[model samples]
Target: MDVAEAMTLLLSPQGRLDPYPAYERLRAHGPVVEAWPGLHVATGYAVIDEVLRDPRYVVSYEPLPQTTVAGWAESPAVASIARSMLRANPPDHGRMRQIVAGAFTPRRVAALREVVTAQAAALVAAMAERGRDGTTVDVLDAFAYPLPIGVICALLGVPEADRSAFRTWTADLTVVLEPEISEAELAVADRGAVALRDYFRDLVEARRRTPADDLTTALVQAHDAEVGRLDAEELLANLVVLLVAGFETTTNLLGNGLVVLLGHPAHAAALRDNPDLAGAYVEELLRIDSPVQVTSRISSVPVAPGGVPVPAGGEVLLLLGAGNRDPERFADPTRFDPTRPQNQPLSFGGGPHYCLGAALARLEARIAFPLLLRALPDLALAGEPRHRARLTLRGYATLPVTTVTRPHQATGVEPRRTVATTSAERRRIARVSAGERGTPTGAGPGTP
Candidate 1:
């Protein structure tokens, strides 16, 4: 099919399931395809990378709560996101990120690594128990959803009971992030946004009354300071963003990663034998099938990537998933090769607006995948998978898998799965023996 025909199919249900073929057709034309007037779609690795890193290209140049976009304030969902760092540009983006970056610092993430490891173990054990009777369980429901959401809620100090509600809220709130937002979708999003705002508003006050040692309290303290580091509205907007982003991407990653690894049993066995390859395996899976697929940016001035021209004020919808599998950048991009050298995929995004949760997401996958594999060695797909019918945050809606209960120790328990001899030891093998890999940032929350 031709370029426009391919683009149409991409947005169709068929293309949503597998956009790679359409991506190949688009990329063959050039690095940047002018899909329509005033709009360009980037399908190549180099061009997408350039667009992500360049400062002149930004999420939005307009001020929030004051943007000229008509009826923006009408939808609480739209208004709140506009105030978030995801929608901010330049000085404001930096300032907002600075205040929240503390929670995801190396020190904090290192600490969180331990928490995630424990959570994964618990969930895996539960999965083992559930599948012990020889019945199938939804992997997405049993493991993927709870593990990441529980960890993020722990960080944000959200109660376990309350987290169940957020699955619906986040789903509704994030529909606003889709490429085309219908009026019906906007109404649902507005309701979801209100629910979130109300919940966080109460949580903020509770933190004020009695501060806790969690991200929410830290943010509450920052907002209430005399300097007014973060205003009440900004505080609410960011908190909502964090909660939604914290789990959504990683949840998708876990689901996507498991479906891929389990489909290739040999790879799963290789990982089970060599625990140290966890990081490399996780990274490659991200490249092959990213959780967050497409991101967009607007140019403030004329720029050319790969000598393809994009005028000032022009918009480009970048297919980040396609960039990860670009043939020029990755030899045999369609195939899974964990040990590929210099493997840097635009999964999390790049430049100043790179995903803040990249490391946490990486660690979660690196830890969870092996644990699941070792816990349920015979894990295999139980039925046909159902994917979420959306382009931006692509993942499985239902990944049913059957499991075989493996033998346990004399204590009638599976011995706790031990990691490598040491943390440094694992990192050593992952980097030196497997291949050196660097985190490449691009089009995560930056995408819409």
Candidate 2:
């Protein structure tokens, strides 16, 4: 298949379920292939890396023009996302990044290591309890969704009780990032954005009145400082960005990582045997099946990536997933090897727009994965996992997993048999169980 046909398949629902084949077709065509007039797609590692790091190829939302979603640009959600560093360029991006960089320093992220480990262990224990009686638990809800949300909320000083609401708002609001989102999804996203902004407005005010040892408090100070590093609108928008970006990507990473680990029990056992390997294991998981599959850029000036010229203002989609699996970049690219040397995946992106929460996301996954394996050694897939129908962000909507209590850890409770007769019924049961347990039923969170 050619690039066009491959891209068409990739954008379809079935294509998303297993885009590797489509990615391979695109890569085989050329390093950089023009998918449409004035629009290019980078499938090779070298070209995608160059495009991401080159200043000439900038984020598409630099000027923050009207979105394809009619009337959405005027919506609070769009406005916030527009102002965020994720979509900004040059002065605005630099300023926004610098303002919050202090809060994500290595020291700060390291401090959260304990928090991530604790939260992961707690969530895994709860999941094990749910499945101890032989009941199937949706890992996406029982574990993956809650761990990152709880940690990010703790970092931002968001109340624990409000984490589920954040999950809901972030999930809906993320649809706005989809390139071909429907009008119905756009409306829902707008509502979520407004609700999130309002909630943050109140939270910021409270933080201003009573400062705490959290990133939000520090941001409040920055906004109110005599230097005025950030304006009120910038503060609120970036806060929303942080809250959404902070948890969403990591949540997907955990879910995707677990799916991969469960699929390869040997690797899962290796990690369980030596938790320290998690750092490398997480990197491989990221490469083999990245949570964020693709990102786009607009040329600020005439530039060429892989010798394919792109005029100023032209757009290019950087296929990170394809790049990660580029044969030229890594030996036996399709193979999942945790010990692969110098493992580098575009999962967290690159350059000035590199995900600000990369360190935190890695820390969460590195700590959470091993802890989860240790806590639930007998974990196995109980039903067909349901992947969310999202193009840009990919992860499970329902990952029903069963765990058997070891003889030594038996709680004397009989396991409940899962009685769903069909995929739809299983999904319904998972959603109902998630709701009853006060967990987020949808995909956990989303990143840019």
Error of 2 at 25 (Å): 2.2
TM-score of each: 0.89, 0.88
Cα displacement (Å) at residue 366, model 2: 1.3
- lDDT per residue (tens digit) for residues 104-198 in model 2: 65655665564455455556656666777889888878777777776666656677556667778988898777655667887898888899999
Regions of model 2 farther than 4 Å from truth: 65-68, 226-228, 406-448
The C-alpha stretches of model 1 lying farther than 4 A from their native spots are 63-73, 226-228, 406-448
lDDT (C-alpha) at residue 369 in model 2: 85
